[model samples]
Target: MAKKVRFYAGVEIDKDGIRHTWSADAWQQFMDSCKKESQAFEIRGRKIAGQCESCYSPAVFYMHLTKSRELSDWPEAGDASGSVSNLATRRDQTGIISILEYTYLLPVSGTPYIALLRSSSGPMPSAIADWVSLKSDMPAAGKSFELQPVLRNDARQKLNESLGVKSLEVRFEGKPDPNSTSSIERAAAEAASTIDESDYANVKVDMSISMGRATVVSNSTEAMRKQALSILTNNNIAKHPIKDMLSKGWVTKLKAKTLQANPESDKPIIEPVDFIKEHLTEDADFGSMKDDEMTPEIILSGMLEAIGKFRKRSNEY
Candidate 1:
């Protein structure tokens, strides 16, 4: 089995913000930055980072926004990780208008696939749709939700000025899907960088495409073929690019998974700190309950308990 490799890249966005542009050199820069940051100290999901796997240039920087954009309202965030969550609650309706976006970059086949996801708080309901709306009745926003980070690809320039190379061949790892790269390239053309419902519904992604070939190297060709097909088909990029790749005997079959499913119970879930308190007590899975159904007293009590935990952590508040 080939070694499992993942890259976390962060690019500094201008005041205008980073657009969805995932390109060859752009992704390379991101991985380089991440490696540099992790050289001495380690953080979330840290592991043994291999030798400088940076084949591209040291131009791009990958940024994981641990904060929110609405909270980035001011012009200069300037090294502040951003208290987006708190600012969001105070915002007009980050509760409704705001969303939680989680992005992942999977490095395979020497290529990168940026997974972008957008999740929102439950929306308001219509008269007759109350019961039905209780569940996830909202439209199923396709694979890429709106307002994904926009990346402006400067692959050629990055390669020449930064990476210092000629045309370096690139591929989306694990799958020889051309559209994976195409998707990233396509995302770069969102035109406007502003956030509006109309455009936000569709993310602008370019560099986040799958860049690589379907590769599974093993002692057994059978195992290699199966593993490659599993990953390629799972990501669904195979159908678009390398249609002829499947024509090969190595690829036996392709199958798409069924649609998956979420909820909006928002029943005052307990935080990790709370769990530690009550001396690691057990209570109702209130988060599974109704948000509107929660009482003021319950809310107050929970806050009090959380404060107590904070006090304990600080040795007094």
Candidate 2:
């Protein structure tokens, strides 16, 4: 009995800009390609937690999702098409940021990252201290991308257990609250004189991702209420849902990497490892402090470090 994994793969867009569907569609295609490679690649099926399984080579995965209609179905385009030019983009503005987020995962083993790329002067890659992540360039030309939700292995097992993970599909269309403060409502209001108290709002919407497809879900508020989680106990979802998303496709490797010798950023999420490493030279063993009370300040200061060192730390009884 595998648990069903459900997560949102969406890009932010303006509700009125007309590009929402286009953005969502393009991301869907990019994720689809990565999924294909995972299922087809060799090493990805070889090792799981360091054992032979279906495919286990160092694996790499990516996702690209948007809220645009034109770009939504580009995944269906024949081989003749590859790039999505401005002609393929549209725009929309919703009260909400209308953000669309995609997710990608890579094996700890050195592989390539495809969902995102850079100009050599772009933002520093999202690599944690004690462990650095490196990715390869995009496989397609004329298309630019950025990697996000870069997670390691805190979520792989749960993903494998959940088949058709996030395979559920549903769409959403919302009515403006008479007292709502979303920017889109003001725009919609300015366009009309005192909208009818019962006027229904609408947009031509479509949404799809690696494991699911859908249009707008009616009565979105109700839907959300129904979907909210009740018990955090026994819940295995990661703190960052994006990273878990990165793990779905073929995974090839999960090797440990060297840390930066000298860095400027005060934050590397590795303060704990650094603290312990420094102490190890003097206090090689826990001595009598294995049961010592750890303080909140000490614990939170090294949370990022704790997160980094956590790889399949859970033991099965």
Candidate 3:
């Protein structure tokens, strides 16, 4: 089966509390710097932990990670397997490694979007976001930034199709950091301060929308629906924890059109390269092809196509 490639928007926050979309030049420089640092770490002959490596295409990079682990095994059976297994367990030192490729594409004069090929063994979207924040050389960019997912093509549609929402719920614990530069976190902090509590172990916010109505919808109800959809879809600046909960199939008493059957969910998964080639309008050479071989050129081309689609849709919107 082909791996799934997810998309994200590349956002950078400046020192003066301004958010800016990274230009192609800025992204190129950042990746080059990360590649250099990753190379240096590799040369030391120590575990890379997790670092980005340059790919054949400058837009793509391999996130290399090494983890030391212990391998355990049951002792060999002598007379009876049950008796021998209960005697002792053997342990050995081992390590795990992964190389996940990701791509960043920014038009010379437009919005920026990134593509990441997902794998169970690879880093997650949030982890990749953190990697960019921690590894980049740009000042103040790390404080409040993320590769925000464009969920318009997915979750937003579901929300629109929903019969008016009964309620949208989000549960949280503790208080948000007051000094955080993130607008979402700042808003949360302000709300928490109004309660005059230093911390909250468990706080559930359930927002009623249409009072369990379905057919009839009001303007206020529509507005609330839009905001709820935004948070659920990750269209907003910060991702809400409720989004994670929903992904895990958790739901309460709330009822909406979002819970309805989704036809697109049954579609077959396609590899990024295959999808790009099938959708391509022109002949492009990828050199020699090997079984399951993914070259940097192929990854870059596929990601560029994905980003182009995103940009087109964005412009139309």
lDDT of 3 at 153: 40
Each candidate structure's TM-score, on Cα atoms with residue i matched to residue i, is 0.18, 0.17, 0.41
Instruction: Tell me how candidate 2 scores on lDDT.
Output: 0.22
17, model 2: CA deviation in Å? 32
Alpha-carbon local distance difference test for all models:
0.24, 0.22, 0.40
Model 1 lDDT per residue over 1-317, tens place: 01111111222223343323345554455456455432211112211121122222222223222212233432221225554444434546433444333222322113223322111211101111111111212223211111111111332122112211111111231222222222322223332233342333332222211112322222432332223222322232212232222211111122211111113542211111110111111122212344443332333233333333333432210
- Relative to the true structure, candidate 1 has a C-alpha RMSD (angstroms) of 24.4
Selected candidate, larger TM-score, 1 vs 2: 1
The parts of candidate 3 lying over 4 Å away from their true place are 15-17, 39-50, 56-111, 137-142, 153-317
CA lDDT for candidate 1? 0.24
Cα miss at 63, model 2 (Å)? Answer: 20
Estimate the overall C-alpha local distance difference test score of candidate 3. Answer: 0.40
How well does candidate 2 score on lDDT at residue 64?
17
Candidate topping TM-score: 3
- Number of the top lDDT candidate: 3
